[model samples]
Target: MSQPYLAPAELTAEFCGRLLDALDAPLALDHVCVDFQAVKSLDSSAVALLLEWHRRAQAAQRQLELMHLPSALSQLIKVYGVEEFLQIKA
Candidate 1:
């Protein structure tokens, strides 16, 4: 398995801003995997986060992977009709 960037338990808009700032640096890996094992709660911001991450990865010609997504987050992705835009592996 690939190394994962552990996601926070709360993936809400309040936390997303900080999270984005933390990840604003250039990505060193061609493939980035974000693990949601610790994410027990989330809102629509989760999808925005994933989309922004995916956008960054794509801009760098890299691949972004999502792992162990919470069921609610998964459903949100679908509800937003952005499932095709993300690479969810779990």
Candidate 2:
């Protein structure tokens, strides 16, 4: 498989808007995987971005996969009770 897309070092509210805007382009593949290894910090906005991505992927008949999520981000997703809405992989 091809390498997954790398997430930015920061996925905070201050940056996620731009990140979301960047995702406006059409996905070139049926499955979209994003790697979070470079993401050192994030907030609830990250969750929002994931939700939006998932929504977009579903609308386009594509699948979204997230990998290597930081523990903090994982906790935030769990805390917000949105894990069921996202597809996270180890």
Candidate 3:
């Protein structure tokens, strides 16, 4: 398997595009893992970006797994009722 995509310390609107761009090259893989352990802060925009990435993965018939999500971000995703879609790792 390929190495997990490491999220930046900050996943705000300004940095999400860079992450997305980085992902473009890896979408061909059957499975993709995004490591969120380093993310110290994120707004709703980060959630949107994640959802978009999920959508892209689905469209490509790929699997997207989000790993080591920070507690705050996990709560945000739960609040939005999208944990299933985001596939947050335990």
Best by lDDT: 3
Model 2 — which ten-residue stretch has the worst lDDT?
21-30
TM-score for each prediction? 0.86, 0.86, 0.86
Which regions of candidate 1 deviate over 4 angstroms? 24-26
Q: Write the per-residue lDDT of candidate 1 for residues 1-90, one digit (tens) a residue.
A: 246789999999888877874444535544777789999778998888888888888887877777788899999998888887786533
lDDT of 2: 0.81
What C-alpha lDDT, on a 0 to 100 scale, does residue 25 get in candidate 1? 53
Ranking by lDDT: 3, 2, 1
Evaluation by lDDT, superior candidate among 1 and 2: 2
Clashes of each: 0, 0, 0
The stretch of ten residues in a row with the least summed lDDT in candidate 3 is 16-25
How many clashes in candidate 3? 0
lDDT of 3 by residue, 10-74 (tens): 98888887777667668786588889889988987788888999988888888887888888877
**Which run of 10 residues does model 1 get worst, by summed lDDT?**
21-30
lDDT of each: 0.78, 0.81, 0.82
In the predicted model 3, the residue pairs found to clash are none
Per-residue alpha-carbon lDDT of candidate 2 for residues 1-90, written as tens digits (9 for 90 to 100): 345778999999999988874444545554777889999889999999988888887887777778888999999889888888886532
**Residue pairs with backbone atoms closer than 3 Å in model 1 (clashes):** none
Give candidate 1's whole-model lDDT: 0.78
